[model samples]
Target: MRYEKIKTLSELKNIIKGLRAKNKRIVFTNGCFELLHAGHASYLQKARAMGDILVVGLNSDSSVRKIKGGPRPVTKEKDRAKVLSLLWCVDFITIFSSTTPFNLLKAVRPDVLVKGGDWKVKDIVGSDLVTSYGGKVKSLPYLKGYSTTGLIKKINLLTPRRCAVRTYAAGKKGNTL
Candidate 1:
């Protein structure tokens, strides 16, 4: 069911065209979304409330690696897209291999472009293109203390190094930890 929400760029463009014919407002946002969190859900919901449809442009695995460096994006792009597709607020998703969503924005031409509060409207990539076409650009409120990096760090702190090694050795020995 969630898989249906993921679309190719051409498919998404056609879908957007149809929606626009019916006067539906399209909201757009892009991110790596390496790990889903409460903050991501809240921001997406808020962005959806601003328009009739919400299209999320997910960064491909290579793109994430380029932007965030090695060993980032703990989850692969397909997995990330699948998780986001499960969210009710996300109408459709398109995976892009670019560092920025500027080209994707040019294709979607969303009615509203949004990003987390951490990004100023002027700093959001494609903000100029969106605004030039009379589309609105918004910076939604970012939830504090909720981030993938923080979650990863917390998880690392909770997993003792010795415990991890023991768990691995036990699994290899056909034993349960």
Candidate 2:
């Protein structure tokens, strides 16, 4: 089940240790993932292809608010994690409340650290730490025209305006309906 894929940091650390012992390559990626989309799935699948396991570090609700400001993360952290857990390409998920995944990266010490093409390898957090340990850091290509913000804007545009609501109410003649 999807719930089984969610793990605490300590639990994930132990699991990573075991996987490493088995010579499994671990790939790590971090994101808010406020809303799952085709782009997210494609990127995750590509990241997983680079290693045996894919560990996604999800930003907590508060962390998302800090980075994206208010009214963001359309979904809560737990919900976001649950959604990511359902993806076949994602092996495990760990929620992090920090502004960045630098600490989480230290814990997992993934064989490969990846971010979207929007981020340069040198600018990606934990790039140095991962590279210092002989681990590879990658910048995956970012899919165009697919983003939570864009989706939200589209939804907003499709919604009826307040003037339309007022017109409908006037037609009701004070009826409860």
- Tell me which residue pairs clash in candidate 2: none
lDDT of 2 by residue, 1-177 (tens): 449999999999999999999999999999999989999999999999999999999999999999999788789999999999888999999999999999999999999999999899999999999999999999999799898888888777864443243334656653332
Number of clashing residue pairs in every model?
0, 0
* C-alpha lDDT (0 to 100) for residue 90 of candidate 1: 100
List the lowest-lDDT window of 10 residues for candidate 1.
159-168
Candidate 1 residue-wise lDDT, 1-177, digit = tens: 549999999999999999999999999999999889999999999999999999999999999999988688899999999999999999999999999999999999999999998899999999999999899999987898898888888777765544544335635753434
| Top TM-score prediction, candidate number | 1
* RMSD (CA, Å), each prediction: 2.7, 4.0
Q: How does each model score on lDDT? A: 0.93, 0.92
Candidate 1, number of clashes: 0
The residue pairs found clashing in candidate 1 are none
